[model samples]
Target: MSAQSLRHQLLTADKPGRADLLFGYLRAHGNKHYEEEGTQMQHALQCAALATRGRESATLVAAALFHDIGHMLADDPVEANNPTLKDDLHEELGANYLKGIFPEAVLQPIQLHVAAKRYLCTLKPAYYEQLSEASQKSFRLQGGPMSEQEIAAFEQHPFHKAAVKLRGWDDQAKDVNVEHLEIDAFRASVLEALS
Candidate 1:
């Protein structure tokens, strides 16, 4: 199936588990990657789970889960370095692709994951120092260190805090083992909650 079709299906998948989409992405597109210490898929799922556990809203959790769906859609592998000579702004790419499919509730956080990372660096003393060299480079490529106006604007977004927490998890998710719930429509209540 084409990547475009797959994303359409995934957006409307009868049973859309963050883990399922992520695992699918890993099996299909993930090349050896580095974002601190984990694979790209690992980073997204961890971010979602971390947000959920922190009592973040369902929109935030959904954003965490689907944030990197763009990586799967990118023209080439984007982990170690750009797979293509052209730009592979996975964060923006992911958010743009997702906005067409998911509600803005979901799209907003997905879009902000990168910003969340940058924002975290400014706030979390050890954050930048702990990033892998590749991620450090990627951060600059992704637009490092939000300017005062940019940071202020970014911070005001509704789900900003959860986005930051998810990014922190994104950075750390790959460094460890990942466990996940199997894909099934979340309990009706869970689905309703997210919807």
Candidate 2:
């Protein structure tokens, strides 16, 4: 199906049908990966799976699944193919697009997940060393670790904790060989969170 058609389906379809369309979109457009070990779809599935396994809220699981979708939706060549390129701010782009469709529970985490990475680096002295090569590269483009003031301010956001947890799962989601729950598994959760 065309990207436009799939997007339309995602916006207007029923829960189960939306799941199928989302899965189709992921399978088609999620093949590109600049830094991570797996395809974008794999990483998304893994992140959502982690959230599901942890028994996080349905909105959180949906947030985890859709966090990086901005990367796929961006028209700029640099967005998906080169994280080392200008910090495309895909998080903001994705979050903005989703805001009209999902509740704050789902949208807020996507907006902050990138900052969560920066915050994690500040909170854990050795966190920078644990990042994958691509993440390490993107870190510089993404403003590196947060400053003390930045951390202090970031902590004030209501979704800060959830974003941090999502960031952790995002980091862990790059394992190419890991088993993952199917995208359709979250139909109920995603549907519930859809605005």
By lDDT, the best candidate is: 2
State each model's CA lDDT, in order.
0.62, 0.81
Cα RMSD, model 1: 5.1
**TM-score of each candidate structure, all chains considered together:** 0.70, 0.86
Which lDDT tens digits does candidate 1 get at residues 122-191? 7775899998787789878877787888889987899687677667766665645678533232232225
Residue-wise C-alpha lDDT for candidate 2, range 1-195, written one tens digit per residue: 545444445668766676666666666678888677688988999999999989999999999999988888685343334333334578987787665568898899999999999998878868878989899888889998788899989999999999999999999899988887777787888887777
Q: Model 2: which residue pairs collide?
A: none
- Model 2 compared with the native: what TM-score? 0.86
lDDT of 2: 0.81
Angstrom error of the Cα, residue 18, model 2: value is 4.1
The residue pairs found clashing in candidate 1 are: 38-174
Q: How many residue pairs clash in each candidate?
A: 1, 0
Relative to the true structure, candidate 2 has a C-alpha RMSD (angstroms) of 4.1
